[model samples]
Target chain A: MKMLFKGTEAIAEAAIRAGCRLYFGYPITPQSELTEYMSRRLPEVNGTFLQAESEVATVNMMYGASCTGRRVMTSTSSPGFSLMMEGISYMAGAQLPAVFVNVVRGGPGLGDIQPAQSDYFQATKGGGHGDYRMIVLAPHTIQEAVDLMNLAFDLADKYRMLVTILADGMLGQMMEPVEFHEMRDLRDMPQKEWALTGASDHKPRKVTSFDIDPYELEKMNLRYQATYKKVEENEVRYEEINTKDADIIVAAYGTMARIVKTTIRMAKEEGIKVGLFRPITLWPFPYKRLNELADTVKNVLTVEMSYGQMLEDVKLGVNGKANTPFYGRSAGVVPTPTEVLEAIKKIMVGDLNGR
Target chain B: MVDKAVDKVIARMPKSLSGKEFTYCPGCHHGIVHRLIAEVIDELGIAGKTLLVAPVGCSVFAYEFFDLDGTVAAHGRAPAVATGMKRALPDRIVFTYQGDGDLASIGTAEIVHAANRGENITTIFINNAVYGMTGGQMAPTTLLGQKTTTTPYGRTVKANGYPIRMSEMLSTLEGSAYIERVMVTTPQNTIKAKRAIKKAFETQIKGLGFSMVEVLSTCPTNWGMTPIEASKWLEENMTKQFPLGVYVDKTKGGN
Candidate 1:
């Protein structure tokens, strides 16, 4: 059954359904509703909810809870997310599973509470102090955000890495009908022998990001690289619409893709033959599919709520095979459908280049 | 050689210890404290259900020293980590071993907030007045008029600031169930320190509240003194600045 739910609350409910009982977070705009929801709802299900001292403590708390082999998650905005970068890096290195929801707000330095995709580079390019990648899922709608929380948790545990739900402020605050799957049984979760349960059943178990010996650390890095490679191979997800017969395929994600879809219809009426390709997984970006599209399509246009962060991946996919043009707005600006159509029209007229 | 006829085991290591040789400096009290905690866990028979959260200072490798399941948290984040562990597994006993710099300085916010919430966890705070792991750097618990790497000319009220008394400060917070300050300079004091640590854990086991024991430790390597001198200096100078005793006792007050 579909229920009318606010975006943030739906994400919280969906996480509870996904067997995530331990949530540690602090309030931030556009995402505070999620934390508030967990605070009220978690206790009904015998879950743990804690408002940590700061985002630094919040992420570290999640890290600690995750070590006990329980599902954990948190939500924050841009500045708070930045504070969590250090802990996120540690979580990634320690091979812990956790989910983070960044209801992205204007950034660079507390620009505003308005929606923006400014944290794309920070999310995809390892914002913290090491070589790590968080499987970033960009959900365009509230229902999708609800659904991706399950994927976020599953992928996090499966890969023993971080998975982030990269939603902008618009999607976080927007209301929509959301449907949840059956509740997951935490008891059904496979036992992680490596977790620090106790020494009674076996020898002492240890988990840490610390491998002081250079050679031992290198070996751990090699193992991490293997997991990342496996993720890249099997977990690429995207949605392509009207792309088979289109002359131009616009690459966008998150809420921006919703606008691009409208632009696609407008361009269709104008005989532009524009298509839409929305990446569901932003980190394991649908690069190979875009490469194939470049072979058949003449122009590839990229639209974003930020200043062309994901465009780099689009460029990497095409690799000089086709003309890549970009149109982006930042600093809390969401480009309209008409503006996207205009960008598509310019790409068709050969007046734009992917710079 | 098994000398069952002539020898009898009097003082032996606790089963909760990992049997690994400690890497702490000579005369360092971390070794003594580690044994004290292990003894408490052994006595309580909670080794199978106890989890240790090691800090990022000299005890960063403390997870390896304990037979209990454990992990290492970043510098000054042990309180938060312990908070997570205890909240997730309330049946499992959770504790953190932290240094003066880890608990009093960088992690002050984490420790205060965790205690303020009354998390059911234990913290073993080693206040050696210097950053032991980082090569004798000045710490927030460094006594005034004492010299160190950061406060080369000696700690002063104006230049550096007054040393933090964590036990007294945290005892005031309603969340804390038991808070105590002790030292392990001599045999008598070591026994008293063990009592304090055991009481702290007992507080957690009783589901009382947050518990901690601030141990006044010696840093002979950093203080430019011999092991024996460091112990004597702790008794003479450190004891005057930071007194030893129970600061809070919720168990006795029916709290």
Candidate 2:
């Protein structure tokens, strides 16, 4: 039940267990292991695994599979993910249930293959040309990655929307103990009446993003907005560590969140009264919870691998109730727990030089 | 006068067609290609289990015309999309209807890789030598010395690359089971083109590897010619550049 596995491998296995029978992806660093694992294992399970020609094809493949209401997913790094933007927008516009795993690396233009949280905006915000939102789940540990991969399919099917598992190069390549969940059979899953299977017993169905008429397009956008509002209301997830009795809260997610946890413990040992606030669901962000935490904290220190991308969200969450400062390392430079602790200490001492 | 004998139904619209009028320009060969595919699907009794992947050109609204289940794919990504559809539901017959710009230009990688993988799907390629939907623009299949919006001075080999022979190129891949280049300019050629489409569909139905039928079509509006003149022009000039006939036929023997 428990085994040492790389985060990418664990996510692949978790996908298999979650009844994801179709895997379409292009190989990118840190996430190639996931695609390679699928290529080997999917056949054994009678599932479809295709190494697509490119990230563009990979996402369109997901779109096709998702049109059949089947559980499908694709994984890529930043540059590859960028290539998939158009397809992702199509999937979102069509309201297809699919999963995307971004083993994020440094970028602006193929910056580096090392881990970075530079894609926070691309993942949470609309990366492609559309007024659409995808459910984004950021996991800090390999085990959490496995768990979230299992849940992503269900949430995607539930909302009939795309779900993104936003991890980083470090989490994807690092090995950790992960307990596998129970295997699910695709046969037991509910059928999607809207799928484009065939016109055997019913009329044919069409999966498309084009509503040429402006009124129909606007109506579709409104429905999508309503669905996203519902997701924000019900699906916000996060974790609060030592925030109950702390003066300073560190807001982070994914790999940065793991480092922030360590910093929280180190600062607590030094009696700095610093805690961690990690957003598990980055899109349906835990803004309300962060607001509640801000009410008790003196200041919020946001840590990230990029140059303060998520800092804007943290500041918005704090809503002028608490002073928010940011400390970040850009272009694939990951900060150590000591460095984060020093940043937290600086914030506590009112010397917000990094801000 | 004796009552006229009841006229027999010489031909009727195939049930696979939804009776929706095509959105293609007048004299567009897409209408003919759509009818041929529908007839094939009907003849094979696969209409109930067929899925068409419509591409992003003039035939982008193909789903509206085909009664079968369908999905509209991004520009040049129909083959990739059809690959997924066929792989996921192997029992279903999948096909992609694409234009020259969509397949030969934007989606070159997808088509080549899908054919190389021997994915069990059919592709109906319409090579009009110019982009249709976005007005007249040079396509990858545009013949040398042909003029278009992008090639106002004519498509010269020095500035623009030579036209791609997709059928011949795809036939070179070992995975492709059947590959043919046919034109719909004349009634005789239309019949030949229909046979090629049916054969490509049959190749897929038999679970053969990649199959494709590239139909050399006419773009009257873009060509700045009347419908009749465009057809004659395609028969004259296009055929010389992109020859017709079966380039590869795995069932008949070899390429």
Candidate 3:
């Protein structure tokens, strides 16, 4: 049976079910519920939950736990997550596996505590220094958010890279029915041998991102790029609704996609052929699939809580094969289903991207 | 080969100290402190299970110098990292080696919180009064009226703040089990520094709480002084601002 669960709490429970026994977090809006849930739930399972002094501390703490070959995670909001950029880069450089959740909010510096996707670029791009890529998971529903927890941890471990759940205040605060899967018994899985348990009976080892030699560092970077190529090849996920005979397709992710789902139903009821293409992995981006889907549609309207951040990707994917128009609400504004439907109606009547 | 009576193995390079040659600048105390930590690890027979958290600076390559599992943390973030490691593996001995800028400045909140929580970990803080890796910028521990690259005309109280006494400041926290200020300028002080490091580790082994040893060090290259002059400068000027003594010792009930 499914039960009503808040998005933030469901995400927390899902991470716990995914064999994450260690968590370090600092409280922030929208996502504070997840931190609070972990603070209580972790102890019940005999897991470690440390409220770090700051996001910087939390990320390093997660890195430390990751070094031990233990599954660890942390959650924060936009401003707080910005402080973790350096640690994120370090984790990527060191090839450490850890999960980070950013329930994004308005940004560019202390943007209010409202939902926004302005961090789309920051999440998919290497927010920190260096040529590193983080596997970003964007979930449109509470159930999907919960379901992706396992994949998030597995991908991090599989790629030996950082995996982040890109959420926002809208989805973080919304409540919906969610059914949890069985908890994973980590004992049944293979342990990471490269973990920093100790050097007893073996040679000493180290896990570090620092290499003074530029040549050696370049080699490591090349290896990371290779791994990213493999990830791109293997981990592209997306959802297509009503695209079999649709004239217009809506592109979005996370909270905005959920809102677009409502718009999809409203549009279909009005006998308008509108489809939705929601990206699950925002970094790998499902660009190939999106391009294929865009080939079938006449126009693709990209919607977001930010001013067309993901629109850039949609435009590239469509490659002018379809009209790639954008509709978004910025600075804590929640674009309603009606607003999105109106935008779709405008697209049906005229090309919004007629540049 | 000499006869058994003709020679005695009074001392040798510590087994835990790896074969890596010292990379620190001349007159720097990091190499000696590294040996001290290795010697203590050897003494305790924990070279196999100790996890070292290296900080960002000249000693950022501490993982290469020690014969154990180790990792380098971002600047001033080592204490927090060690907290996670120790918490994750309760049986493992976790420690951080950090510099003044890393610990006393950028990482102040992390270190204080780690100490306040009584995290079962150890810290070896290197206070060289100047940011060694960043071209000798004035550190939080840089003495007032001391000239650094950033403070070209000698630090003034009106502009740059006075040297921060981290050991004294941290010892005041209730969760700290051990906190000491030591220097490695002289042989005697080096011995004392090693003793402090060992006691800090013992405190962790005893499951007491957070333990730290803040070692006053020299930066000859950055200080524009010869090795000998650097040692003298540390002894004469650094000690004046940061006293040498134990500030906290919960193992002995209190200090």
Per-candidate DockQ values are 0.85, 0.79, 0.85
- Stretch of 10 with least lDDT, candidate 3 chain A: A346-355
Summarize candidate 3's per-residue lDDT along B45-114 as a digit string, tens digits. Answer: 9888899999998898888988889999999899888988998999999999999999999999999999
Q: What lDDT does candidate 2 reach at residue A240?
A: 84
Comparing candidate 2 with candidate 3, which one achieves the higher DockQ?
3
Q: For model 3, what is the alpha-carbon lDDT of residue A224? A: 96
lDDT of 2 by residue, A2-96 (tens): 89999899999999999998999888897899999999999999998988989999998888888888999988999998999999999999999
lDDT of 1 by residue, A224-257 (tens): 8899999999999999999888878889999999
Clash pairs, model 1 backbone: A324-A354
Against the true structure, what is each candidate's TM-score?
Answer: 0.98, 0.96, 0.96
User: In model 2 chain A, where is the ten-residue run with the lowest total lDDT?
Assistant: A346-355
- Candidate 2 CA-lDDT value: 0.90
lDDT at A316, model 1: 95
Q: lDDT per residue, candidate 2, B43-147, as tens digits? A: 989988898999998889999999999989999999988988887899998999999999999999999999999998999999999999899999998999999
